[model samples]
Target: EEEHTSCEIPRDAIDVCGVQDPDDVSLDNVKEVLDSIKVLFEEDKTIKAYRLWKKLEGLVGQYEEAPQEQELSDKLMNAKELITESMFMLNQVTMEAESVFALLEELDSEEGWELAKDEAGIRTWFKQPEGSPTYHIKIQGTIKSPIFDVLALVNEVDLYQKWIPTCDLSKAVLNISKFKRMIQLCMTPPSPVNWVVSRRELMLYGYGVDMMEDNKMIAMAKSPSPGE
Candidate 1:
């Protein structure tokens, strides 16, 4: 029998068919984002990968299901004063990438290419910092591949189950202006535990933020109305 690849999954299939294996991914040679970065100055290909990967890793956390009880949500939000933490690690990588790129440019043309990492497992400059809470994360990057197509996936609810692990349903109450969206979501964790959870979210997005990281950055800057 032929191996069942992801492309084989039928449309409207509710369950997430497979989780991407980290080992099968290659982060090196991250798609060199020459348009924006190159315009600013020069940068290494690896550092670009590093910044982008960290940003992507940050999204995995955004996929978390809402808390079970209203009380729990209140307690959690009140305690933390927010639903999620801003991605500091990702910003750090961006700065680091910029630094390395500057270093590479100063060296001879031969040296810049020499300094660039072109290995399979490691990208040109993305680095994993040592520490807690962040070390568990890994960056798997791609460059200019037709594979990402994240833009098309934005409003495609069916595809969420394919990539986001905990999304049961995502109903868009509004999409007028990116910041004005109100979305409802439910929890659907991986099985051995294939049951729905009671918690729901009607969060807003795109306000109180500027465009960042090729537009993958999502900052919730507003609260939705009760009905919205």
Candidate 2:
């Protein structure tokens, strides 16, 4: 049989979010982040994303500062990146992620990283600036599948690992009102390319299935930091 064809999605369809002050986030704060980022490629406001990204990093770093198992710290900073979006949202995430990082790389190269690999070193370099998502991958295909069936499958919540790209595990947590769930997955593709890992942690990760009661998956998406 031929490989399955997956759906396509637009890049702006995602919500780039953080849950640190989830309770405090108002529509205004979200609008500010969105507006500031548009000028990120311009020299002036680039620092805004840097500052925010560093604050986010500091939150993670503080955990590292606490006495913890070496294994734990490694896992924290060296988190394998997760591609939280489904095939429907993959391409959209990719273009958005690329735009975010390209701007950051330009700034970081000014003082920080050389943006080049060290030929002599065993470790390869991944160039992500202070405030940037490391990277994101895009996968596209078409399925003869229908949307209502997909919704029924989503109600099951046990079938994602078989088809969803980024998810390693999934389970339903909220049923009717919100339709929420928990998911975990390895960041690397089904086949690992090369090592030297990096990640943009999505403070919150979720999957949603769209349907019209006929039992097919018309659309699905995820919210997480896109990857490199």
Candidate 3:
């Protein structure tokens, strides 16, 4: 059987369709490319969109500040706005992806860790496959404050009693080095013991994470020093 195929035009073609003039310097191609990029971003192809945004940023720069060419100027401005919007969205997605990947990688590494305690934004874990006399505690969480603020709060020995509920007294005993300290903490338990005094060796280690540095503070106390 012989079949005939025919193209049908929509009823709204009169309102939506137009012929492109050869002399008109329009940004139709740029608009189409930007629209496709928007679709890619919507589909969670952020890396691709980001790459395109960087390329479009350069292309759009060429037509910028051309007052004599009003049409070209308008097209460039439109492209610039679109590029900016795409860049902002792509950056946000990139940040979210990084955060999620970091958390996932951490979880993957901690294959056998059991959640011991969860409070607010902090999570604590008890070490599995134990082999040492000292119990190891693994704490993992994200703080909304800047990393510097966290490091400062941890290293300030004088502020411990003010913030810690069990601490009766806190003092900086000695500054061994920039990354180490000897701190004294006195605690009064609910029992008959009047006071308990102890000294802790606080060691600080910092490592870079993206644009910021993450600090790890380790406090070790084997035997309590005599309090006079």
Question: What is candidate 2's lDDT per residue for 154-196, written digit by digit as tens?
Answer: 6665676677776555555444224334444433344353244
Please list the residue runs of candidate 2 whose C-alpha ends up more than 4 Å from where it truly belongs after superposition.
1-142, 165-167, 173-178, 186-220, 224-228
Positional deviation of residue 130's Cα in model 3 after best superposition, in angstroms:
4.2
| Per-residue lDDT of model 3, residues 60-132, tens digit only | 5555633437667666767666656555454644553344355546555767677899999899987646576
Which residue runs does candidate 3 get wrong by more than 4 Å?
A: 1-112, 118-120, 128-134, 191-228
**Which number leads on TM-score?**
3
Estimate candidate 1's alpha-carbon lDDT, on a 0 to 1 scale.
0.38
* RMSD (CA, angstroms), candidate 3: 21.6
Of the two candidates 1 and 3, the one with more favorable TM-score, higher being better, is: 3
What order do you get sorting by lDDT, best first?
A: 3, 2, 1
CA lDDT of every candidate: 0.38, 0.39, 0.51
TM-score of 3: 0.34
The count of backbone overlaps in candidate 2 is 20
Candidate 2 vs candidate 3, lDDT winner: 3
Question: Residue 58 deviation, candidate 2, in Å?
Answer: 39
C-alpha TM-score for every candidate: 0.28, 0.26, 0.34
Residue-pair clashes per prediction, in order, are 5, 20, 0
